[model samples]
Target: MARPYEPGPSTSLSTNTLSQTPSSPVPEEDDDSGAASPELPLTMSASVMLADLPRDATAALASVGGFPQEKVVVKFKPVGAAPSLAQELCKISATRKFEEVVRYLRRKLRCKDTDSVFLYVNSAFAPSLDEVVGNLHQCFKNGQDQLIVAYSMTPAFG
Candidate 1:
């Protein structure tokens, strides 16, 4: 029997990091010699499974009133794969979880919050709309019954 795949907790998945590099003579508070913060810079991305589907794409755009246009991306593979594919997959995943990805980018890269996150789309790889919608609907139904919060996240503060 083909065992079904299960997703672990999403906590570790949040990849928010500083968007910019710190400037100049490192702010020295007292003479602690050479001590650096543990926090490091990182990039953000995501991946979705389309095991039994067609095509591959990254993101779709949605307009939210007042808020910036929400750019939702789709990824057809899991977290790890070939180098190039993995990078693309991560990009897509990042788009889906825009807030988390942006937080990481801005925090690590020191990018401005106003900067636009170009959600990439691997349309050459994504599955068809019918399959995507159907699978999502089924997942939604199952999660609903179990009261699973599939894709909820906390708000980010500056």
Candidate 2:
């Protein structure tokens, strides 16, 4: 049978770099050089595993007040040398994927299969093709209640 383990003086070694008795509960003082010690005291905090959901998914779902509107207004803007559309604004189904917007732009521009087009939301970021249009509208809609989409013939915005 194994002997019961015991914590002796040797086992309870000083974990801190400062010279202090084991019984002392005081924190070590800063150095005369006016620099704080690199070592920091350990702290315990409780955390919860929020199921099998990503942080953005949870936050997006939480911020949206209710079901997305049936349709969302998308206002397209041309960047760089890209051609402008006669009708700059159009209405699209909210539940449609972002790929629809891309396809629509391509059809309007009469682009060939080899031609590449880039789209950005609020002229800021290029979202995934599979992302929902409603979510994009909800997140980046302008004061005029329209989703501002900046289109380019090549990768433009950062």
Candidate 3:
């Protein structure tokens, strides 16, 4: 009969035996100099994952066609030394510019070349003439759903 099989310590596999194999190349050590060694080049993959984001509501509305024109109500309040118009409340197109409001006030007051008129929104800072009246009214309308504008012959609130 053949001899019975026997387990021995030398028959077991170990990390030392695997690393000693000739398949992998060993790194060489540099000379004992004080100079820094060059680093290995990094490798990267170019694949990227992009997430879908929702579109802006305003931009979506604009693409269908520009914002619809609406009638805006303007309430005029005269400051110190400023003359009031015959009609304090008037309706204007939302697409009109603030300069149009200034011109309308000037025409109603019959202002002279030397006269100056200043307009403010909510008695606060003065907006640029090029600003759209509709945009301003939408942003700063009073509780009555009216654009409250204060006018003065001289600079009052600056």
Tens digit of lDDT per residue, candidate 1, span 36-125?
A: 322322222222456653333322222211222223232322222211222321222212333454343334334465653232112122
lDDT of 1: 0.28
Stretches of model 3 off by over 4 angstroms after superposition = 1-59, 63-69
TM-score of each: 0.17, 0.59, 0.60
The alpha-carbon RMSD values of the candidates against the true structure, listed in the order shown, are: 29.1, 10.7, 18.2
Worst 10 residues of 2 by lDDT: 38-47
What lDDT, from 0 to 1, does candidate 2 have? Answer: 0.82
- Which portions of model 2 miss their true places by more than 4 Å? 1-66
Model 3 weakest lDDT span, ten residues long:
37-46
The candidate maximizing lDDT is 2
Best by TM-score: 3
Residue pairs clashing in model 3 are none
C-alpha displacement of 107 in model 3, angstroms? 0.3
Between prediction 2 and prediction 3, the one with superior TM-score is 3
lDDT (CA) for every model shown?
0.28, 0.82, 0.77
